[model samples]
Target: MRFLPRIVTFFLLLPSYAWTQTMHNKRYNVLLICVDDLMPELGCYGNSIVKSPYIDSLAARSAVFTKHYVTVPTCGASRYSLLRSTLPRTKAALGNEAAKILSDPETAIGNEPETFIEQYRRNGYHTVGIGKISHSPDGYRYPYAGPKSDQRELPRSWDEVSFNPGKWGHGWNAFFAYADGESRITMQGEVPPYEAADVPDEGYPDGLTAALAVDKLKMLARQEKPFFMGVGFFKPHLPFNAPQQYWDLYDAGHLPLTAVPNIPANINLASLHNSAEFNQYRLGEESAALDQPLSDGYARKLIHGYYACISYVDAQVGKVLQALEETGLADRTVVVLWSDHGWHLGDYRVWGKHTLFDRALRSVLMIKTPAMSRCKVVNRITSTIDIGPTLLELCDLPPLSQADGRSLIPLLNDVQDKAWADVAYSYYNHGISMVTPQFRLTRYFRKEQPVIELYDHATDPLETRNIAERSPDIIRQLTPLWERGNTGVYAK
Candidate 1:
């Protein structure tokens, strides 16, 4: 009788043991690097002025997404969408949604409410979030009552670092401090001295976050556990503060200027939300010289500053990558570097990203996988939503019901049997922009009125000429496509 029981137990345990072994072999690690307020202006993206060697190198090793667009333009809204893999209706709605989730967890939005980090945790992968992974820190806290509403309700997935406390706009060499309620004049290109204990760009919140990530990589290597690490960098967004060396690299005399003409008189200012606020900041620049023709020289200087911040962020990325390589995690790790949304350096007569312009909506996305060859650039149109499903596929995890993204695995594997097209959508305030491989169509909606703008991206990459009136049929063809909601895998 004892021998019979042992035989039965051995037979039963075989399947479970085989399953465990399969799961272990299929597990893959993920490293998600997110930058704040960055646009697709890196050297890999063909910008000559910005010096982002780390990102450039990463680009060489990954699939460079040339037409990746975010669902929103602002930081909080855009990051929320990327985290959730869903687009917000408008800027105000997005902000309010974030506020509600942070204020009262029970009332958070989204029907399918699970974060990718949580999913990775469910699959036995260790997860860590550093820096600005969540829109605001408070969002991570519980609701004081029942089950928490935010996707982070799954607590086991993340381990966050302490918030680095510091002055808001200290690092950048900009002339004005948007810090206080009232703007004040500050010296431009002035690099303040710092103590050895003082934080460097990498040592600050972003740098500390990256350092913690590197440590986690090391720990994971020892344990042989697959990890999903999210390292968020907060720079090049506002204050534009970088080390003195970075600021010195850009000569204001040769900076490139913005080239947006005056807003047409026929357009209503009310159509664009928060136009007055944008103009207020521009007027505050106190540059009598900018009143004349916009010059690329001045624009190049701002570009240089933006690039310095990017390079600063890139160095942190290199740290994480180095740790991955040293830990022998590089071969199995799937690295994805992305920005929340594009930044506007005086494009469309706007200094920031609150509008539905390409400069404001586009982002840089690079993905490196063990399955793909190096230096491959995919010029297809994709969205932030695709990130969720793609990571899930990479980890061999089952797709979540709430995820509205599609897996880019087929695209990554270079499977010619599959056919894909470039199609991305972006929204800000009340405006929505649909980007095809060759065309960008924007529809600005109001309470009772709507305006449409179309640009042939192949010819008018800058979006200077609006051909909406000239191409009515094309507008008609694309409007219906925009109307279809949740067209991704989750919808099916």
Candidate 2:
């Protein structure tokens, strides 16, 4: 009887042992790198001027997404959508506190949506985050001055949420601080829109963020379990601050200006603003206006500063990637680099991201999986929210139950698949825009007047003219897409 019991125990243990071994052998790690306000302007994306050698080199071994669009133009709202794999459910979801608000048990509904990072942490992975992964850069709740509270922004998402604010005392300060540690709030609109300090990368917060991520990568290398590490860089977003070396790389004379700087014809003044965000920096050479254009010299200077910031962020990315190689974890890691949303250099006489145009919604997205080949580009219309589900699929994890995004695995596996969604959607305030291969249709529920805007991408890629008056048939066809994207909200 004793021998029979021993035999049965051994048989039962065999399956469990084999399952453990399989899980151990096939566990793939993830490194998610997020950049703020980055568009597809790297050399890899055919922008010959931007000096982004590191990101371009990484793109050579990754799947570059050419037409990836975010659900919203602002950073916090877009990041929230990416993390939850869902669209914004309320107007609060479009603000800087979107994550903190949506994840609260008091405010959230239906058992609360699970962030992909939380999902990984639950499934035996060592999940970590540093710098601006959420609305709060430090991953904690803090005020402007110092001493962040222990309360987490995403409560249960990270095993380790760490950041080094460097010269500035805390995350929010560093977010708006310059190379010399002078913060924007302190300056109170006294500073210029761009700066090129004669200092090393450490003079900015991103360099410190890179160093900390590299250290964490080293620590995670010794552990036997897998890791999902997120590193978010804040640069090229505001202040356009970069090391002087990066700024020196670009010549102001040769930098290109926006081909379309005027507002579109037959458009309501409500459709565009006077670039209030850019003008808020008091030291700017000129205040943006709808009735006038910025001086050519001043415009070139701003573009030059934007390019320098891109290079600065690119250098920090290179350092973190190098650490992965040094730790001998490169082959086992899935690398994903993306931006929160796009920014307008001079498009439509606007200088910020609070618009429904492609200039504000189209962002840079690239991924390099362990099984992916080198230098592949996918030109399909994809959303930023699709990333969470794609990572889950690649890691062989179960699908997220509350996810509103579809996996991009099909497109990654074969770029020519025809079953993908042709339209990409974006929303801000009371308006929603649906972008298809042929047209971008937008509608606004304004109390003053009913507005409809349509632009044919094939002919008016710059959106310089709205053809809604002549394109009635196109509007009827695209209205359903716009309605479906709105999800029954803001349709009045």
Candidate 3:
């Protein structure tokens, strides 16, 4: 009788063992779309004013993370955490040049991988990078060299780093390019803050990028090996230039301005900064100030520019996603849309990122796996550090040993997974912030008064005021959580 039971168990395990082998061998493609300076103010996110139809369509069939945050508010540092799946441990790890280690000739790619893309490359996947995958547009260090320079930002990660500059001479020029074939750099601070060029989509670099991605999808579809394609869109970031048609989609006068325009009360000036990044446009009609808010007219106009750029990007994104479907790769591909970090669109009297506030740290995160049948809202707090492991798991690739983030497969399976932790950590402006459902606690490293701050999301979701002084008991409860995040910021 015992032998008969053992034989039955062996027969039952055969099907499951074959299924496991198939899962490991399955070739699932990845389409990673990285947008710069995009906030969660999309139509899908319940924003009434924005017109993001293409992204909203993707969100309809995807897992939209409502509380997705980045490890840093800046571009490169946040992307560093996403690519490495590791938290920032040193001051250099928190800077924009953090990923330069992957491209620097002196640095060696040893036994460990520097990025998830590299890991994917190792496991028989063809990786292609387009547009601004790294801090440098076109994945090259063109800012310090000529257009024809050969310097690379992520040299070994991608099989190829390519882009189309359109009318602009090079990638960097295309990034800051205007319709007149001149860029912000070439114009030397003489250009205005925004433009509604009367030209086709090809007039902007992102348009060219979308076209290139579409063409690449056709090529990748014919290849045997699975591929990982990263399409980084650079728009709605600075100079907010888009086609006039997109700008016409909104009435600037009726569009809503930011809530809580001034810096939050009870916070020191050291915790905030003057709008230096926004003021870089010397010819802009109005300069942003910390002491006062921008004029209503200017603020509305700027918001209009931002919205127009978003619509423009939305159309470009539609073209790429459509190409995926046309190529017949949509069924087997895992598509992910994420932003490097959120931008301060006149929120907190600041016009850019680099703050630990919610607006600056939170951005768009949408994932559409082939197995998911309908849209699901993931309400738990997730971080950029979790993206790499999630992608690897979705693709059934071996996990990277050095990643600090946990796979979000459980949340993806069950949107309201009770076993999941609901906290996300962010670092910026010499501060480490812990984000939960009801509160945000921050501890600053600088020698300023009121170095610790807390915001109650239930009453003041906009973070209009700091209640750390009045809520002593809450601070005591959140301090341990804040310290737990602090440990990740510093290496032992």
Candidate 1 lDDT over residue span 1-492, tens digit each: 000000011111111111111234668788898888888877778765667778777777677777788877776677766766766543343552453442344644443435667678777777777656656432244332213234442244475433332332221111122322111223322321111122355434456556777787788888766778887777666545455555555565654455453442234444333333234334333221223423555445445566566766777788888898899988788889988887656555455676777777888898887654456656566888888888887778877676656777656655231476567777665666788867877776555343777888777777767788878898888877766542231221
Span of ten consecutive residues with least summed lDDT in model 1:
1-10
Off by over 4 Å in 2: 1-26, 109-113, 145-147, 448-450
RMSD to true structure for each model, in Å? 12.5, 11.1, 9.1
Each model's backbone clash number: 17, 0, 0
Candidate 2 global TM-score? 0.92
Candidate 3 lDDT for residue 165: 81
Clashing pairs for model 2 are none
Which candidate would rank higher by lDDT, 1 or 3? 3
User: Comparing 2 and 3 by TM-score, which wins?
Assistant: 3
- Please report the TM-score between candidate 1 and the true structure: 0.77
Off by over 4 Å in 1: 1-24, 89-93, 96-103, 108-113, 137-162, 166-199, 202-204, 259-301, 415-418, 447-450, 485-492
Window of ten residues with lowest summed lDDT in model 2: 1-10
Worst 10 residues of 3 by lDDT: 1-10
Candidate ordering by TM-score (highest first): 3, 2, 1
